[model samples]
Target: MKRLGLILLLLIGGFSVKASYKQDTTIVEFTDRGVKKRVTVYTSSKKDFELPRNLNLENVLRSMGVDSSERKKALVLIEQNGAKQDTILLLANDGRTVKIVAKDARDQLSRRDTLRNDSDHWSRSGRNNDDDEDDDDTTTYVKPKKKNSGGRFFSKSDFGFYLGLNNWANGASTVPSLQTWGSRFIALSFRRNATLINGKQMDLALSYGPEISWNNFMFEGNDYIDRSTEQVEFLVATKDLNKSKLVETSLNLPVMFNFGFEEAKLKIGIGGYVGYRVGSYRKLKYSDSRRKEINRDNFGLNDFRYGLTVEIGRRRGISFFGRYDMGDLFKSGQKNAAGLQAWTIGIRL
Candidate 1:
């Protein structure tokens, strides 16, 4: 250690540096005042270039080589590729600096590129302590391990579709008598997730996003919503209809807090959502070769609705979701034969 320190001191103090063989990087650790610091030097052509002979780091950083001086020195690592070179540097608020200077004899770095990229890379405003944690924070070229775990319901973020079936659960009246297979539900949404806890057993995350959903309720019988009354009413169509359905479009916001089990990437979440009806209408198709009929209105449906949601399945793959909206499907205080609330179940991607 003493010999290496003497060698670095001599090299930094405008002396000389010599090594037996070429290496990619040389790491040095030192202390300035109470803080610990580290320097890592690299080279462009490890086999061809010589250190200290080509680098005058003291002049570039305005640092001193004396142990008594608080002006800490840094490491310089250079890499060359064709006409361009890369200089690695550390940016910390403290005096410690690490720089990489790349050589490009044919095509020098533009002044704009130097000022924009290298300057930012070389200088930062943060504490510079001798602690490895502190120095590591100021400079790290390590790439994170990418995870393929961003699924429909468990992910850092995702945008996709949810497709499934629509039906009314816990309904006393007959407002939404939907066909078993004809009623369709779909949601287009972007989900954002934040991890709250991560461990060997499980990881918990909160997810939320805006959703635009469409629900088509196809009546099992020849009935459609009547538009004249203040209360919701199911009216039998005068003609023999091939298809009768009511379509509802809603803008919703849902939040879910989920626990992801480490094994199988399994996840489960329970959350609720609030939504506003954006548009609603009814349609009828005749048995004859007649085009579909259309009528647009609120149809006594509630404009604002809230509901509970459940999500469970593989984190990066298929998932099942269920949603149930609360309260009557109409304005409060209105009475109709069928009082119904909407529910949906489907696969999410």
Candidate 2:
């Protein structure tokens, strides 16, 4: 009984001394539009001074020369960082300075080690764990477990844009008069990729996607695709023209098989695509006051075409892609640009 009394007296004396030292520690609390909130702020003020518990929020803000909106924002900041050591408000006292810090600014080991089955958890300094030492802030060792029996999805998906150059490919001759710079190719593609063969040295993946592509073949000078001659002919206009081109849009499905070199951080893929022409037209812009003219027609272009695609880049990021048409760009019996096929090279995002 005598020993218990002595321990109680010592604990009470320690608490009293601590309270005396903390009496001058003015904490800046947060108040939101007349509603009192709890946000602890340690301030560096004069040792003899003690801030009031219910300081007039409006008057205190007015003295700081802050407007009404700013006061609301400050309150919001405090509210968002509730019960956290958000920051320090420094009053002119000695050589003290304010310090702003994160609320749960515990050591970094408190974070979860997110990996496969070997993920180990770390406990914070003050957190009570099931271990023998309640105050130990060390990492809790976790044994590695067997991989999941069901397995994980080899999932990777993307929606990306491609922009670059376009041209025609034919075995007989070339459309050399086409403007290289103005013949722009654009495509929008959405794809899902999955691991086909996951191995130690290399990995293989299969990607299948839907693509919408546009080809603009801006011809040079007066050259235009003339459909009125019963065939698609790139004829020079007699009327000094300003602009002439043929536009084709298609909906395509592309399938690619990719090989990934893990250490090299490179992925190379080859595949094929099949597409149907959705829309086609020819436009003529006159230099004089004849006004811009547009003709909506197939212009002897084939309705369906299949092509080969090749991709190269990192597994995920801006990559390079190229496609070449294996079928005719024009119908087989069209007699004009019949063998011309479309091919494009561009960067994919």
Candidate 3:
């Protein structure tokens, strides 16, 4: 199952493109009041391009005498070409004046059938030289390229943390699961992934965090005590208390399978998580000496739980998500085991 998830994640992560280049160009096509236009420009290689600052399409059209009304309604098309290419801009209106320049020898010749005699003569001589050398070096040779995964889909993600308000319900309000109670708790978590198995899109990961929670409960086997009536019944009284606050810290391991659409920019996935409670905060806090609160540290909490997780993200930068704990956090007979289920809301970071 874990291997399956790892495969899913890697497969989903494989589609996003990440390449480095120094130069690029922008191609723009515009239609103003039914007029079509196009232009291209070449630029120096750089990591990022500043929009408008480098080339102002609006200003260019205005300089060409295009009317203000036509400019406002113009439909624009923009394409990012690598630094090696020229930025292309087009304006259909006669009002707009566009400066056209040749990017290379081919571009210069594209508009004319005229050929440079010297270049043609030089090409013929070069071809003759190539034929003589080709036979001399009969060893068909090629340079080998370095094999690298390169930084593709995800290099890293941001940290995420969240809490759920309605975790459980019982009698009057009970949630589906081992425990039941209307409660609120917070889950602070950190997640990371690794591609362990080959030929699969599943990823293995770890997440752990602490939580603070509050809930009401009636202890098993104890005489029911009603603080409202200031009465302790020997046989039928029910144990009644306002609420209890507890702390839980756990370590979780989850295996997930992911699937992506449109180059892994959009994704959806489902997986399961296993957890171990490393610490707990269950001691009661009281302000007065007249009514002493009891501690059930030795009787409650199983310390282990498991659940399923759903994830979605747009590359490694932006993600939104949720998680649900499906397993019990109690031993067979612990008193506090009655309430331990939790929920989480955090980012993919």
Candidate 4:
């Protein structure tokens, strides 16, 4: 009777042990938004609790009640045993589905080594046969890092120089012949760019800032820019028209809408600018004695200038720009120059 009793007791003990091993499970609990969610992960054996090799992180996120649209901005914290890892969900490079990307910690261990160490620790803990007791290991939770959105605002600044061919249009009379090579316009600007729409493959931006524009109109005829009368008068000089030039300077405010395409390889900007005249003057050179004269006067130029501006080119490469003034070049007092307007076209550097 004693021998029979001992055999039955051993069988009962073996069955209890097997049932306990089969009941081992891992419960993961987290909060998404304001809702609480829980998931149960079953282990294949008591000695090992491994997630499936083809586990889909996106599906896990969805199961946790995360909204599909908000998933891209969501961060996931995974804790196993005592080790913790932070991951972010992102669209795959092919743009077909979502994937997990580990936010690397500052530890010196390689990713493979870290994961291996974690698995080894869990395996060792399981072999100790302490499944019924609560684990004393401290739970580590990794916090997500903040991202820089860099939206359209005071985020970035740019500086550039522009050189353009200058010309003038007159409706009352024939346009004066100009020294095309010497007639030039130049501008220097400091612009602040704000991103309006930051798309995955393209970006739309707006830039506005202070600019200084200088217009130099070189004439072929022997003419003098008369500030007193606000008009040009023919001059009789022993020497031919060696040099006849009128210069105008203004402080301008330019705003532009920029479209960047092909990963910013190509860019186009269309905008307008308004400026207030700051200074004006005339310079003349005589051929007989090669004498030069500088007259610092308003030269009857308009007090304000406004224009339409355009730019197109490769990013950080040579670009072409054009500006057509809508305001008259000279004030209304000049009879024949009532419809005179200035325009420029050139390359930017």
Candidate 5:
């Protein structure tokens, strides 16, 4: 029994020694004043530390507004030999027993060491430190990555088509000067997008294409038709002379600016365009006042027009829109003539 007890005691003693663990620690020193202050850091968790970490000391320095280059100069390694690993960092605030604790593990120390090395190397070569954890607010310049610089790509281009109703002016001398609207005009257009200033601030677009238009105008004054030479009854001839359709085709160009609101969903812009009349439709009808079948033809008026456009809409790859135009389509002396204008709603892609 005595021999068995001795063996059991020896086994117990062996187990106790194997189970015991001593943690590693560090001491970092810096001058706060003429007095030397020592910062003791505990590394008890370091022995089991696996490195190549996701963290670093640069991030820590940046958060505290510390110069990483200067901080790296103060780092030092101390050998603890067999002493109990002082895993506790005690800063002597005063001279005696009152100490402030700064705790760090092996993983954190490893991260710090990597950051300090990078900073020191950067300072020696006059290069910016690339440590993830070490950021200096004092840095005034940061070189951007190459990919951040703009490159050529068709992904930024724009293209779209729109359809709208237009009005052509009827320039009649006797009619109300402000009454320019005549007949329904149909228009088709294509546009290209330009640069985008900020994510949501400003945009410029350009559009152009062709339009088909029709309008009518009439005027009958005693002086316009000589009274003495008028042979037929006035009432019958006047009705035929005052009514006819004028058709026009034109090529147009427009430049527009888009101002966005509500995260680029809502926008409004104003622009202007000039249209060249490519051709016209000529028709003949009876003149009632002349009391005879007479051909009515006026082909000199529809030549060129210039006008303004205003648009407003919501833009989300597709846009709902409205437009207005203000210009004259006929030459000054041409009777009962007006310009080109339209109100439209359309989408953008």
Candidate 6:
């Protein structure tokens, strides 16, 4: 009877030891600048362990062989036994945090791709999922279509360049003809487009943005622009006006109404822009010296300008644009200056 009892006691002790070893898990808590994070590490052995003493979180991650660049953006977490690892929390610079979890290998490409997909969804629905944690767990992430991806009529933002011909209309007697191909208007802008109506066949949108418009007007014949006083004058050059040109630059705010059809394949925008004169200059090429001379001045140009613009084309295809200024080129009190309104026509790419 004593031998049988001893054997049973030994068997029970051995089973308890095995159970403890199987359940060995270490919970590590990391605190940095009042921010606390926790991770659970499971171990097969029941031996006790401790993290390196007096080490920072960054140093700890480095010791784990994490790249330096990723250390700043990565959140390290360990899985709990039998608990679903369904979401990951991401921190942003503006104190906003987002949660993301990959459902499969296809969704685990790069962080950029993940954020881009989320951004497209947010842009379309104007809803952010960061604050809503109780929604359905199974989210199907389909890569967004590239149609009008570059410049959608209802997109929140887009950027592009503007190129066109620059000329002027004078209300006075007659303005000199411009060098047809030599005169040019060039600009770059950052735009915001808002959807008013999105439909299967047609869409209506509104757009507004800031732009820098550079106007280069090449003269015809021996004519040159002069601004000795409050008035802007057109003077005939003693020498040939080979490459004499006037350049005006302004900072402008443009607003437009846009219509799009067939998934933005055909788009038309009508808008107006208001600008403040930022710079004015003149360039002259002298035949005698065969040298180019540049002069920077206000040139009696108007301090403020307003203009109308029209755009028509395929969203990503070549588009035609036209601009006509409603205000005079120079300030009031310019004698015989007439209308002196500037205009441009060109293609937008």
Give one digit per residue, the lDDT tens place, for model 4 in 223-305: 65554564654344455768888899999999999887633357889999999999988898987776798999876678999
Per-residue CA lDDT of model 6 for 63-166, tens digit only, reads 33335564454333212212232233332233222222312223333453345542322111112333222223323333323324343335678886899988
TM-score for each prediction?
A: 0.56, 0.57, 0.41, 0.56, 0.37, 0.56
Each prediction's whole-model lDDT (CA): 0.59, 0.61, 0.36, 0.59, 0.35, 0.61
lDDT of 2: 0.61
Query: On residues 1-349, what C-alpha lDDT tens digit does candidate 5 reach at each position?
Result: 8546534644553343222212222112211121122222111122221111112232222222334452342232112212222111111212111111222322234343454542211111122323211333422221211111142111233444454433324434443322234334455555554534433223343333343433332222211221122121112233444333344566777666656542224567567767776766533344554333323333544466666666666554545545444554444443333332334334433
lDDT of 3 by residue, 1-349 (tens): 8546534543442221111011121112212112212232212122222122112345434433446664453322222222222322223344122222213232333211242221211000111121221232322222211111222222223245443443432211221231233334444454443333222222332222333222233222322222222221113324433333444556666556654432224555577777776665443333333344554342245577777878787644545666667765454443323444556554544
The worst-scoring run of ten residues by lDDT in candidate 4 lies at 35-44
Candidate 1 lDDT, tens digit per residue, 1-349? 8546644544553211112112232232111111111222322112221112112343223321213122233321221122243334433234233333334433544453353442212222223233222244544432222233532224678896999998886665555477989999999988888888865447788989999999999987678777686666778877788999989999999998988875445899899999999999999998876889899998878899899999898866888999987766677655763457888899999
Error of 4 at 114 (Å): 8.2
Which stretches of candidate 6 lie above 4 Å from their native place?
1-153
Q: Can you give the lDDT of residue 2 in candidate 5?
A: 50
lDDT (0-100) at residue 203 of candidate 4? 69
Runs in model 3 lying further than 4 Å from the true structure? 1-149, 156-166, 169-191, 195-243, 258-264, 267-269, 283-299, 316-318, 334-342, 346-349
Taking all chains together, the TM-score of candidate 2 against the true structure is 0.57
Q: Higher lDDT: candidate 1 or 3? A: 1
Where does candidate 4 stray beyond 4 Å? 1-155, 227-238
